[model samples]
Target: MRVLLVDDEHELVCALAERLGFRGVRADYAVSAEQALELARTTAYDIAVLDVKMPGMGGLELHQRLRELQPDLPAVFLTGHGSELDFAAGAARGEAYLVKPVGIEVLLETFARIAGPWDGQGGRQP
Candidate 1:
C-alpha cells in the first residue's frame, strides 16, 4: 500500500516512513500541511497518516482538504499530545485516531483494517 505521512516532527516522521518502506509499504512523508497537500494532489495514496496537531493547518483541516481533492480518502490521525479535544475532533469526523509512539505493526494493521489488503497496486486507478 502507498501511504502519506505528515508531521512536523522531522525525525519521527522520517523514521516512520522509513520503517514502512522497510516493510514493503510505499511511504511518502511531508513536514508541513502545505507539502502534504502538494503530495496529495499528485499521488493517490491508499491511506494518509496525519499529525492531528500541526503548526498551521492542523490535521483535521488538512484531512478535509484531502477529501476534497480525493473523496473517500481514508485518514488516520496521529498525535503525541493526545489532547481530549483532539481525540474528540478526530472521532467526530469519523476518522481513526492513533496516539504517537505507535508501533509500525499497529499502523500496518490499521491501514489494512481501513483500506483493506494492499492489492499490490499502491493506489486507486484514477
Candidate 2:
C-alpha cells in the first residue's frame, strides 16, 4: 500500500524509504511534520510511518492531524529513543510502534497485521 514516512533525520528516512521501495512498498517520506501534513492532504495513504520525536511537531500530534485528514489511516511509530513514556503513549493510542533500525520485514509485517491483505500493491484496490 501507499505509505507516508516522516522523520527528522533525512538520511535515515530516505534510506528507509528506498529500502521499502526495494521491497515493493511505495513510501513517500518527509523530514518535518508540516511537509508530512502537506503530503497527507494530497495523498491517500494507506499507512503512515512516523518518528515519535521530531523537531517542531512530534509524531503523536502529526498522527492526530493525519487522522483528521484520513480517519481510517493506520499508523506505525518509529523511535530511536525507545522511551517508556513513548511506548506507553503509543500503546494507549493503539498505535503499533517499533524502535529505530527496524528491519523492513518487521515494518511490513506490522503493516500486514494492522492493515490486512497487504499485497505490496500500493493500494491497487480500485
Per-residue lDDT of 4 in model 1: 90
Q: Which stretches of candidate 1 lie over 4 Å from their true place?
A: 119-126
Candidates in order have lDDT scores of 0.85, 0.86
**Index of the highest-lDDT prediction:** 2
Residue-wise C-alpha lDDT for candidate 2, range 39-103, written one tens digit per residue: 99998898999998999899988999999999988889888887898899876664588898898
- Candidate 1 lDDT over 2-108, as tens digits, reads 89999999999999888887766889999999999999999888788998888999998999999998898889998887788878988787358998789888888
Note the clash tally of each candidate.
0, 0
How many times do residue backbones clash in model 1?
Answer: 0
List of clashing residue pairs for candidate 2: none
Q: Each model's TM-score?
A: 0.89, 0.91
- Candidate 1 C-alpha error for residue 50, in Å: 0.5
Q: Ten residues in a row with the worst lDDT in model 2?
A: 117-126
Candidate 2 runs further than 4 Å off: 124-126
In model 1, where is the ten-residue run with the lowest total lDDT? 117-126
